[model samples]
Target: MLPNGKTNLIALDLGIHGDPIKALERIVQIAKSGVDDHVVARELIALSDGRAETRPVLGMFLGGAGLADSILYCRNQIYPLGLSNGLSHFLTAIAVLVSLLFGIRARFLPPSSNPVRISLIRDGELAGRFSVLIVTTLEKLLLGTRTGESQRGNMKLMAVDQSLSALLRLGWASLFRRMGKTKMQGIHLEQGDTIRIEGDHSSVILDGELFEASEGHPIVLRSTQPVPFLRLAA
Candidate 1:
């Protein structure tokens, strides 16, 4: 997608559809009861044809050191997995250790052209690339710069823009100048913001379905009013 459109979404949620008229009646009943916001939302019995920014910006899970996978994180996307997943974890540990000791980020990626912009408009483009670019009215993201923990269900659009969001390691420490949003590598989007990306032969995946972008036909993203969809707890 050029910005965030051309929909082919595949999400797994509870299959519960209720009558809108009855739903309205229940909503009014709930409003009179003055229940919690989450409770009120849960009581809502309708569906919303919502839109999401499906222009998949490389969404990677670094193996969980709180950053991607477990205590050590590959700020860069360095996944030298071994024979088995456990072995992969071991390899990850060794790689991180070696990288820190040698003061070298063992990463090599093609230079990006005119980094993608996640903004409200082309004129107000924000320069940066992110590992996790999330636009939602949910809890804060896990290991995020601001929240530092997984979302507890709140609201906001946050983006962790970077080809490699710095590691608090020896090598990265020496290159402090290269590790920050100040270099136009961060995000906090309000409503009406649009994410624009331009590249040769750009391909976008929406809800797992893929599509290609070409000249005169670009992908686009826009905001949507909150949908009255069912919220099933996991």
Candidate 2:
């Protein structure tokens, strides 16, 4: 049961049937409402119940964190394997930590021949640029796989442990570097930085759901707030 007197979850698939803009706006509204992280998690879980494959629930939590300092306070930070919900929180934690640690990062993936231009915008101006954005795309593409495809363009739940360990040991150090032939770019960004992707107006999958964009208009991604994601014992 949720804190909002709800026994069932709301079907709010942000990037799917719902509009990303409106969904973001709603999340912002919820953030402003001063709701507890547990409540937020429950609502998110309910919202993402049916579409486990897409993992939109994980995306919403991360996207909320990216917007502001929110949290997904869960009762079980770690649970038995039977209760594991696809390791979504753990996977998201790694992605968020990596994003925070690394600035404007993207990896070019194979199999897809097209190149996309991704820019990091700060205060309405270009701050960083990526000729190839592969990491997150590949992460979404390879979701639900038993194992991470490859270290080159794939990320797994173990990354969360890596990020946490790095944080505990290194106390905010820069560790991202350009690797491989693709020349993945990284630009250091301050808090509240916005990432804008402008390519041939192709559709993008953020977290899991697909977002459509036009060539003339760019899709803006922002994480003005850092969301605290709690990991349950599983």
Best by TM-score: 1
Lowest summed lDDT across 10 adjacent residues in model 2 is found at 1-10
lDDT of model number 2: 0.30
What TM-score, over all chains together, does every model reach?
0.37, 0.29
- Give one digit per residue, the lDDT tens place, for model 2 in 112-229: 1123444534334332222112222111111221122333211211111113343332222222221222211232222223345454534444333445435676555533222333
Off by over 4 Å in 1: 1-114, 137-157, 163-195, 212-216, 232-234
lDDT by residue (23-93, candidate 1, tens digit) is 44555665676545423121111111113433323221111111122122322233343244445445555
TM-score of 2: 0.29
**lDDT, candidate 1, at 35:** 40
Q: What is the lDDT for 196 in model 2?
A: 53
